[model samples]
Target: MNGPSLAIRQRSLGDLTAEFPLFPPLTRGCPKSSTDEIAYPLEVGYDYARVDPGLFDQTPGTDIARWSPLLPPLAAPTLGEGGTPLVEFEGIHFKDESRNPTWSHKDRLNRVTVSAALAAGAPGVVVASSGNHGASAAAYAARAGLRAIVLTSADSPPAVQAFARAYGARVVSVPAEARWPLLREVVDRLGYHPVSNQTVTHTGHPFGPEGYKTIAYELFLQLGQAPAAVFTPTGYAELLYGVWKGFVELKLLGLTGTTPRMFACEPAADGPHARALATGAPAAIVETFPSAAYGIAGPVGGHRGVLAVRDSGGEAVLVTDEEMRLAQRDLAGQGLWQELSGAAGVAGYRKLRREFGGPVVCVGTSSGFKDLGVGAQTYPVLEHPTLDDLRA
Candidate 1:
């Protein structure tokens, strides 16, 4: 769908300006102070408070004393990511993100990041993505009237390439290892804003995950309480971190009594988060291998993934390719045809269903088109066999 679409039992986060719990405060990782920095002239008409980290993070105990411009309140036509379907299945709930503009949950991050780019007066945006993120960035940039450059793997799925081009992004194909440095140069040399990430490590942009907070907010509003557990398919683990942080902030603000246990579902070929949780370390020292679920084939979780798992009383689980394929079939039975990685959450729920009591949400991250290259296929030639010819 070209426009926004959400298929949930209708509900809303009414009066986004109304008093809710303050965002939970967390330590800001900014530098001590600016030294040897010359003052530059400021631009007018843009809200001066837009650049403050608090505008995005909104930590607890924050005092909004000044007239800070908030994100335009969540309204209709959300591009199908945040207000996804919260359907019931044998008492378990599913948050289906396939209905988004780009057919993935990445739309949430790109929406928030694109807004930040526009607010900051950026000329355009650049990103390095295998699929969903690039399409999402491109779509949002088109909406915002900014140029978008997508540095993607040469081997990206054709459907994804078509999606990127359809949204007006300049698609640049490159090797996996070569893409990052090129993206950095694009930002430092070309002045195009880096929306994906630029830190030496996998520290993504400050405002990117802010978009993910809406998922948790929707969960509470939809169910009228926190779930007993929540599971997500993991790659960089940004969504996992966002959901956990959102709930923690909610608890701090007295919006919820407690946070649910978050879980990461990884493809067994490269179960980095699972390994990291097993080792009890902040970082997982491993390498990713190619798999059917290309979206979740990362070597390890990003900077904040481990912390999210630890803080939310969560653990990571791995599903084999065969199991994931079976999950795809199972979800199809539920009338949800998702990508291979999209089935990871359902696979996790199937494994751990007996342990949980209250409502559980399994996040379906993307549409099946994202991984159309990997799967079983069969074809038959025209035989023209009539009624009784094949019955014997």
Candidate 2:
């Protein structure tokens, strides 16, 4: 069956109009050839036949026009996810994902994840996330008319819980150690499509990266040229892989002549990916000590972290919680509110500011609400309803 016709929408960033890349059909070796089955290069167990890469990209236009085509036909109720602002700061451009539908970059991944579920004939989708990814999956699944089951850390923010519940997803609270296994059971027993990291090597769903490639496609159109570099906050390094893959594909398609250097900013509390990159190992597993940037805190499962750093000519830099916190506060002063994980890109840039010579883009991965419950909380309460008392 021919899939639904994709909407080719144009987005206007200032005076420049760019089209989102058309979604190409899935084929062996990432080509649209006469292959009977979709073959992926990921070294893991994946039913490649169930995924279609076409739902990932569309011609860029306004946020509506660009993402409208990326959504399913008869899909309605848009909340403005895709066209996040590409903010410029100190010769660096940043994709402020604080503006995404649920205030995180996970929206991009879910847009395609839900589409894949539809193509695969799955009844629902499941993912385990501390914050953004589960919330985004829940939102998109609701839009796709599919059920969503989110297995998340019980310690996650109330905002994240509210968002998932708001979308009608069944939120299963579990200890962090039990999340992945329970998610696996749900996927196996109920046949829900799993969107979380599954491999010991960090290789996520074969089709999920297709959604992330749109970031590079957007960068190319928005700047009218590729920047000198693109930086991302790294947890499992999925976003890093997605952006690099997109640029590599673009270069292959003859749409771009040069690829930008990619960099990953990782929290020092769990810098396994950085350690792996530094040691030339297949993958690095660190004894993680959690920090304020809970979004990017975890033991990286596989070697994709090494792969992302090596392939993109990227270096992984470690940022302390204090550094990320300062970066968060600085960004908020600019009217860009982001979570600690979301601000890691800026932290990376600040660390290498002396070395960076030209245009750079750092991805601010999510809104600050995801981390509001991370530490001590205090709020002043008004004892009396008086304007003068409030002002005082």
Candidate 3:
């Protein structure tokens, strides 16, 4: 993974201040400006001037760790998380992230964050997630020979719980509000790495989203140019910001003519990003309603997502549960079965049918198997019947 010499720094998303080192994995919300009302997330900043765009010209391999120059340096093990297929169906390009090792886009995030844990010499990794994040973190921790502890909601899907336990992670079912506070205690007492958000506002691990930048890099190489738009399912908007940052870097390196419009797709039941954008606020806390797309039902919005949407001339789009269900079925009809949240990008595209033209990319972020009620539907079966009986 050797490349040009690299130095990593932490920058505040609020004022673009480079005040912190990249190590120790900072996740605290950035300091707020006197004039501003809220603090922003800190981001992992690289010396992009030293990066060679030619390094990205090569077709991406199965290992995302190969993009080490753009990411924080760590000796993390790999499970072939990146290089997912970019398939076209119904006039849209789909980045099939569900094909990743852990069957979700969270695999990319955990790949780097777990590396941060190992680099910091932490005893283990801890995460609070209802589904994908916990499962992915647990698997990566196992790969790196570190203990894993996951705090999930008591009502988390059986499959997600099983997946984490299968990887030898200690899965604790706790109240929703208690997860973050408990994670903080674990980090303080046991010296474990906290991979998810612990702040009141969601400033996730600084190095985690760097793993998702590979999606934009892959899209460019696969299409030979940047698409007109990219729609991603948004929870904390980590993937949304990561993909947007990737394209921004390409333009900075004289590789792409223009960046795509980044769309942060969220469940309408709880669209904190959309609410923040609509209200002209740095962040928003929205009252949430139940939705089958539980994976993306984040109650709070973050500053990173707002920056991504505003900078890229993108907008936050909300899709209803029914819209997501229809989109999921449509993908299944085309032989791509995604979880309801994974289909939010497509649902958003449908909602904005008249807005954009030209090539568009929508990321299918996870597999259908991650959905809690995915297998509840069944069809009647008849035995000992002939073709006539079947027709009747």
Candidate 4:
């Protein structure tokens, strides 16, 4: 049986025109694109022609290992990362990634990134993240028996901070602009592996996004076919691009006849991915404002996202904080407690207000517990009263 990696070489996302050896993992952007001042990430190429179609016959089990042929070299143990459910709430289908091991879709990405760490014989892994990304990386690193370090913004959710620390990561809070530089130092001076971006733009670990492709494979199995369109919360757009790439691989394997229009949902305060898509640039950098949906809020945009939207003929949708609040409440009423940023997909769909020819899927990126103010709300409780109190 073909094991967890069929990856042969790394290909530049700039034009899918350049290739490099898969070893010495490219955590930063491709050299060609980096010289151009735009960080175009690399995608791991696989021998897809040799893949067995029977692999897709069954659902992925505890982790993403079931789709090993399409993934990069995974050297870590499974922590029950994949196998999330697709639940239909109200009118749209939600992929429900909060069910993942770390309670966020980022587990899928870190599963492979951490494997890259282990494969490289690194002592540990380091990342600069304020929320879900940090927490997921810590959990996966712990599972892989690697030391983890998480650099977060000062205002990162306390619950998330505790979550990462509980996983034995050395968690630190720094100024928003200081994380990446510190992380590079940790990688260079300390010789720890870096799982997050260390570029002018958001070019993350090449192998990690390959983990996200499993979502598309799982969705295809769940829906029995590809949905018409998929709306995903977008920050760096790695999740969006990875999901689109999964479907692209499926098509390349001669499985799916059609591909879904990939929608990139961003915070209205700072829609870098949306702006980049509209402007037709390879990537963009935009000024940001405060938004509660911080998980999907970013200043610099990555070319991977622009490629996903443009390639899929999909449009980027921007939603406001108020809109996300409504969407979050809506999902809560229906028994899914997603983070504010997690609800951006549904918010984007509603903002579009356009029905598709077939089913549309919305991705819920993380659990409500990962929100910036998870424990802040105070709900009034009734004192012991009687039937009258109940009636009132």
Give per-model TM-scores: 0.78, 0.80, 0.95, 0.97
Query: What is the per-residue lDDT of model 2 for residues 11-71, given as tens digits with 9 covering 90 to 100?
Result: 2111122222223212112222112221222411122233344533444432332523233
Q: Which of the two, 2 or 4, has more TM-score?
A: 4
lDDT of each: 0.67, 0.70, 0.87, 0.90
Residue 86 alpha-carbon offset, candidate 3, angstroms? 1.1
Error at 136, model 3, angstroms:
0.4
The C-alpha stretches of model 3 lying farther than 4 A from their native spots are 2-5, 31-39, 355-357, 376-385, 388-392
Candidate 3 lDDT, 153-224, residue by residue in tens: 988898889999999999999999899889999999999988998776678888878889889988889999
Specify the highest-lDDT model's number.
Answer: 4
Clash pairs (backbone) in predicted model 3: none
Task: Return the candidate ranking by TM-score, descending.
Answer: 4, 3, 2, 1
Per-residue lDDT for 331 in model 3?
95
Model 4 lDDT tens row, 171-246: 9999988998899999999989999999988888988789999999999999999999999999999999999999
TM-score of 3: 0.95
Candidate 1 residues lying further than 4 Å off, grouped into runs, are 1-81, 374-378, 381-392
For residue 390, what is the lDDT in candidate 1?
Answer: 63
Worst 10 residues of 4 by lDDT: 1-10
Q: Which stretches of candidate 2 lie over 4 Å from their true place?
A: 1-79, 374-376, 381-392
